[model samples]
Target: MKIIAKNKVAYYDYEILETFEAGISLMGWEVKSIRANKVNLKNSFAYFKDLELYWSNAHISLYMAVKGDEQRTRKLLMHKSELKKIHFKKTTNRLTLIPLSLYWKQGKIKLELALAKGKTKYDKRQSEKAKEEKRKIEKMLKNYS
Candidate 1:
C-alpha cells in the first residue's frame, strides 16, 4: 500500500480504539489532485447520516482548472453490515470516527478511519511523559553498551 497523507494531530489528540477501511467517492479531478499530492487529512472526520457515511473537512486541493470547494463533504463506501456495527459502536460508546490515513490499495483510494476517544489535557501530558521516559531509558541503555 502506498500512503498518501496521514492525520498527525489525530494521533496526538485521540486514543484509537479500532480501525476500519473504506473507499472514498471522488470526482475525476479530485482524484487527480490527490495524486498530485495536494490532499490533507489532518482535520478530517467521518459521520453517519441517513444510515450512510460521509466524510468532511478533508481537503483535496482543486485541480488547477476546476473551481470547487476543497473541503466539501464526500461519501465513504463501506459494507452495510460494517456500517451498522460502526454506527452502533460510535453511539453506544460515545466514540468518534476520524480518518487516520489515506492510501492506495490495489489501484483504489482507501481511507483508514479510527474509532477514537478524545484525550483530556492530563492524558496528553501523561503520554508525553511516558514517551520522554522511554526515550531516556533507550539513551541510557545505548550509552551503557
Candidate 2:
C-alpha cells in the first residue's frame, strides 16, 4: 500500500486503542487528485450524523481539469455493524475517531481510522522525552559504528 497522506499529529495527540480500515466515497476528480498525491489529512476527523459516518476538514486539492470543492465533506463506507460498534465506543467510552492515514490498497483507496483518547499534557511531555532519549541512543550507536 502506498500512503498518499498522513495525519502525523494524530499519533502525537491521541493514544490509539483500536484501528479500522475503511473505504472512502470520493468524486472522480477527487480520486484523480488523490492519485496525484494532492491530499491533506491534517485537521480532519470522522463524525457520525444520523447514523452515517462522514469525513470532515480533509482537503483534496482540485484537479486542474475538474471543477469541484476542495474541502467537501466525504462519506465513509463501512458496514452497519461496524458503524454501530464505533458509535457505541464513541458515545459510551468517550473515545474519538481520527483518520490516521490515507493510502492505496490493491488499487483502491482506503482510510485508516483509529479509536483514540486524547493525550494529556503530561503524556505528551513524556512521549517527547522518550523520543529525545531514543534519538540520543540512535546517534550514539551510529557514532560508535
Per-model TM-score versus the true fold: 0.98, 0.92
> In model 1, which regions exceed 4 Å deviation?
none
Candidate-wise lDDT, in order? 0.96, 0.94
Model 2, residue 63: C-alpha shift (Å): 0.6
Candidate 2 residue 75 C-alpha distance from true site, Å: 0.7
The superposed Cα distance between candidate 2 and the true structure at residue 86, in angstroms, equals: 1.0
Q: Pairs clashing in candidate 1? A: none
lDDT of each residue in 46-134, candidate 2, tens digit only: 99999999999998999987777899999999999999999999999999899999999999999999999999999999999999999
Which candidate comes out best when scored by TM-score?
1
Stretches off by above 4 angstroms in model 2 are 141-145
Candidate 2 least-lDDT 10 residues: 62-71
